[model samples]
Target: MWGPSFSLRDRDRMLEGEWHTIRLASSKKEKVEEEGSMRVFMEHMKALEDKSIGFKFHTIANEECVDHYVVADETETGEYSVEYDGHNKFTLFDADPGAYAIFDLTNFKDGKSFNLVALYAREPDVSQEIKNKFEELREKHGIPKENMVDLTQAVGLIPERVLVPTLQIPVATLEKEETPDPPVLSGDFSPGLQHHPFLSTHHPATSSHI
Candidate 1:
């Protein structure tokens, strides 16, 4: 992502609906993890009066859904920001409209930080051309080819974009558990990501959420 590669050529056709985490890589990842089912729903919102878009990341692990969000504004073009981590930078650099999106997240928490680039696709997989583009962007970020990992490898899953009901259970009412819920951004932030962000989403200050 460079010089603001976010496209507004066709807003709805490109950015709306559900997407899957195809490939994810980081400047620190040296190995790949075993595959499993990972579900994350990126709810695209029009809550702001301006042409800004809100992205809320949530998951259903053991039937627990939390609330957290970040807004990205665009009159004709735009970028993004993370609300959780005070020392983090979120950027949406290049996107192929509805086809795919490439974003880089630099998460800094507890004075530790790592750069990550993710490829989100409308479907479960990406084309070879798109993969090349992803690698190109990561390489530009000083991330080598060895750092990349196919999160969707050998994992066959494709879910349609369906309307999910909002979290009606208040935070206070929801029961707390030992394991951290996905993407709340309230946990520890450590180096060397252990979980695929698609499985356990993270923002900042959290041990593992992307």
Candidate 2:
């Protein structure tokens, strides 16, 4: 019931292609957010083969969108060392491989560590069955419900973001997949871009040089 539990499910190419952020929760925030938009692209590098994953986060700020790249290398079954906003440890769990996935990430900045959980789906959203299991997993991890935001439900449910230093706001946009283009900041994920409070929430990585 303590420590981190990394799911050992076999998921070859499960993370490949595009994903939308359906839910995002941070212990430091109130309520799970359900009315924000952020898309992710995962590419499997066969040349790196079990070495790394091509990861990026597309976020909308103002009326414009920007892509931030992350350097990710597989260190364990469901664990990765990443670079974005400094260094981070990303862990995967409760993955459906084809439907959805929930992951925990701890990002180290300056001299502090920040942790949050996120739910990503292949479609605009996932089935209730997938969401139900994610809910269970969430409680199991002791993640406060108030600290998360669910984006798959009512847009009217959008809550004003809590005031926090260094936190950026996400625009109210529905999930949409687009063609992958070169990132505006590959391995250079400065908060200058649309930095989601939760990694609702996937940030970038820089295991090596940025």
Judging by TM-score against the true structure, name the best candidate. Answer: 2
Q: Write the per-residue lDDT of candidate 1 for residues 1-210, one digit (tens) a residue.
A: 223555443363347666677787777563222221122334443334454555655443323444346665443224444444344465666776567887777667677767778788777788899888888878888987777777555332222221123313466655563656677666766644354333433333122212
How high a TM-score does candidate 2 get?
0.57
Give the TM-score comparing model 1 with the true structure, all chains together: 0.53
lDDT of 2 by residue, 28-106 (tens): 4522332233222222212135556656555433323345555567664567776665677777766765667777777
Query: Residue 9 in candidate 2 has what lDDT?
Result: 27
RMSD of each: 14.7, 13.8
Model 1 RMSD, rounded to 1 decimal: 14.7
Residue pairs in collision within model 1: 14-97, 14-98, 188-206, 188-207, 201-209, 202-209, 202-210
Per-model TM against the reference: 0.53, 0.57
Off by over 4 Å in 2: 1-12, 30-50, 76-78, 153-210
